[model samples]
Structures are given as structure tokens and as C-alpha cells.
Target: MIRHTVGRLVSTVVIALTLALFALPMLWLAAAPFDASPAITASLPQFTLDNFAAILDNPYALGSIRNSLIQGGGAAVLVVVLAALAAYALSRVRVPGRDLLLYLLLLLSSVVTGTAAMVPIFELATRLNLIDTHLGVILVVSGGLLPAAIFILKDFMDETPTSYEESARVFGASPLQILRDIVIPLVRPGLATIAVWALASVWGGFLFQFILLRDPDKAPGSVILYTLYTEGGSPKLDLISTFSLLYSLPVVLMYLFVSQRYGFRFHGGIKR
Candidate 1:
């Protein structure tokens, strides 16, 4: 009885510590923006909007959110559209070495991340006259993300029954029509997942956007946030903490909205 009690107490302590480790940063993030003298440690906010006001006065700060929206949203849409098409095709067609090809692509994408291949990517972008362009960044980001997106979506597409397609075919629906009308609605949860994943990836991406875009004005929120540092490279926490909250809010809201609407639970396969 003593051993069991001790074990339970130890486990509880460990769990509490783990939770505190994760929660402290979040607590600071939640509180520090409103704190007049924001510090690394968590404390009660002074309930001031001065941090927000200072951030707003910085031209790059608020504008970076718009840039992020454009880049993130564009990249996400491209990824979803292309991934959905590729995933559906792979799911339906019996191509030789298909699974191998998919795995190979995924492996290469994972192995050759943007940072590792930045030199070649930059060279290629320059050659294509894509330097300093949002389109260039969007395309580059989309290319890196495609394999994984397709891989995730393929499972969802594969699980969807062909009965719906067959029924649409009986009604003389074309492949495009069948895909648009039937398959899309059925696999919407998967699409939402991909969209959210892609958006978050693109939104948080700093290196790719920083390396690709020369003009600070065109920089995304991630890149702009990097400028929130002192000459000695210590973060200007008062400004950054507020910016971080603003930067994170959109993605969090998006996630909550999608979770409420679609619920990420897999129904295994669609029933007739």
C-alpha cells in the first residue's frame, strides 16, 4: 500500500512538472503583452495596451500580418489543390512503383529541407528571375510541402468509397464533375487538415522568406519578428511578446474554427 501510494505521488509530481514546463511559456505569452515591464518570467499583466500601441506604430509590424496572409494563404491553396489532385490520382490509379515513388519523394523532401538546399534553391530562383518575388517564395514553399501533403491526403482519398464515383458516373458525370461534386465534399476534413497544416508551415517559415525576399517591406510576419531585437541581439520582449500574440492568434483561431466545424476524427471510410 505504501509503495503504490508513493508511486502515485511520484507520477503526479512528474506530470505536474511536465505540465508546468509547457504551461509557463504559454502563461508568459498570454500575460506579458499587457505587462508594462514585460520580462521572461510570468507575472500579472498591468492591463496596458501600450505594448500593442508601440507595435502598431511600427510600419512593418501590422503590415507583416498582411504579407503573411498573402504568402501563407497562397502557398496553402496551391498545396491543397495540387495535393488533392495528386493524392486522388495516386489513390485511384495503379501505377507501377507508385508507392515507392511517393515514398521516395517524401524521403527526398524530408532529407533535403529548405535550409540544406537553400543555396541551390536561391541559384535556381535567381536564374528563373523569381528573386525578391512573393510568387517565387510561394512556389518554393509549395514544392517543399507537396510530397507530405499528398501522402497525408492519399490515405483520406483511398478510404473514400468508389461507390459515389460510380453513382456519379451512372448519372453521366465526368471525372472532373465527380471529383468536384462528390469526392471533394467527402474528403473535406482531410482538405481542412492540409490547409491548416500548410498555412501554419508557411506562416511560421522565416528562413525561406528571408532568403528569398530582399525588401523588408515584402517580408512576412515571421521575418518581421526577427527584426525585434536589440543591437546586442537580445529580444525586445515588450514589442515581440505583443507581436507574437498577434502573429499566433490567426492560426489558433483558424485551428479552433476548423476543429469545431470538421472535427479531425477519421470515420475510417465513407459509408454509402
Candidate 2:
């Protein structure tokens, strides 16, 4: 009885400590944005909106948020559309070595990351006149995310009963029509998952956007956040905190909205 009690006590303490470790940073992030003179540690805020005002005055701060929205939203749309199409095709069609090909693509994409292939990517982008372009960054991000998106979506596709498609076919529905009218509705949760995943991936991404876009005006929040530092290489915690709060809000709001709408429970498409 004593051993069991001790084990439970120890587990409770460990869990509390783990929660505190994660919670402290979030607490600071929420509090420090409003602090008149923010610090590394979380404390009661001096309670001023001046930090936000200062962010507005910075030339690149708000624009960077817009740029981030454009890149993240664009890449997300492109990835979801392409991934849905490819996943559906691979699910319905019995092409030789199709599973092998999907696995190979997923493996290659994981192995040859943007950072690893940045040199070749840069060269290709330069040759294609894609340097310093938002479209370039969006395309590159979408390409990198597509394989995994397809892999995930394929499972949802596989789980969907083909009876609906067969019924649509009897009505003389084309493959595209069946996909649009029948399959898509059933697999919407998977689509939502992919959209959220893709957006999150691009939202936090820094390396590709930083490398591809040279214009400060076109830089995303991730890239601009990196520049929030003093000449002596110290971080500008005040601006960083303020901008980080603003930068984080969009994705957080999106996640909340999606979660409320769909409820992420899934065993293939959506748990029923």
C-alpha cells in the first residue's frame, strides 16, 4: 500500500513539473506582451498597450504578418488541392508499384529537406526567375509538404467505402464528379487535417522564405522575428514578445476554429 501511494505521489509530482515547464513560457508569452518593460521572466504586467503601438510603428512588423498570411494560406491551399487529387487517384487506381512509389516519395521528401537541398533549390529557382518571389516560396513549401499530405490523406481515402463512388458511376458521373460530389464529403476531416497541418508548417517556416525572399517588405513574421535583436546581438525581448504574441494569434485562432468545427478525433477519416 505504501509503495503504491509513493508511486502515485511521484507520478503526480512529475506531471505537475512537466506542465509547469510548458506552461511557464506560455504564461510569459501572454503576460509580457502587455508589460511596459517586458523581461525574460514572467511577472505581473505594468499593463500598457504601448508595446503594440510600437510594433505598429516598426516598418516591417505588420507587413510581415500580411506576408506570412499570404505565403502560409497560399501554400496550404495548393497543398490541400494537389494532395487531395493525388491521394484520391492513388487510392482508386491500381497502378503497379503505387504504394512503393508513395512510400518512396514520402521517404525522399523527408530525407531531402529544404535545408539539405537549399543550394540546388536556389539554383533552380534562380534559373526560373523565382528569386525574391512569394510565389516561389509558396510553391517550394507546397512541394515539400505534398508527399506527407498525400500519404496521410490516402489513408482516409482508403477507409471511405467505394459504394458511394459506384452509385455515382451508375448515374454516369465522371471520375472528377464522383471525387468532387461523393468522396470529398466523406473525407473532409482528412482535408481539414491536411489544411491545418500545411498552414502550421508554413506558418512557422523560416528557412525557405528567408532564403527565397530578399525583400524586407515580403518577409514573413518568422523571418522578421529573427531580426528583433540589438546591435550587440542581444534579443529585443519587448518587441520579440509583442510580435510573437501577434504572430501566434492567427494560427491559434485557426486551430481553435477548426477544432470546434470538426473535432480532430480520427481513425482514418473522422471517428464516428
Q: Please, what are the lDDT tens digits per residue for candidate 2 over residues 4-80?
A: 99999999999999999999999999899899888886568899998899899999999999999999999999999
Task: Report the C-alpha lDDT of model 1 over 43-77, residue by residue, as the tens digit.
Answer: 57778899999999999998899999999999999
Question: Model 1 compared with the native: what TM-score?
Answer: 0.95
Candidate 1 C-alpha RMSD relative to the actual structure: 1.5
Q: Evaluate residue 222 in candidate 2 and report its C-alpha lDDT on the 0 to 100 scale.
A: 98
**In model 2, where is the ten-residue run with the lowest total lDDT?**
263-272
Residue-pair clashes, model 2:
0
User: For residue 104, what is the lDDT in candidate 2?
Assistant: 100
- TM-scores of the models, in the order given: 0.95, 0.96
Choose the strongest candidate by lDDT: 1
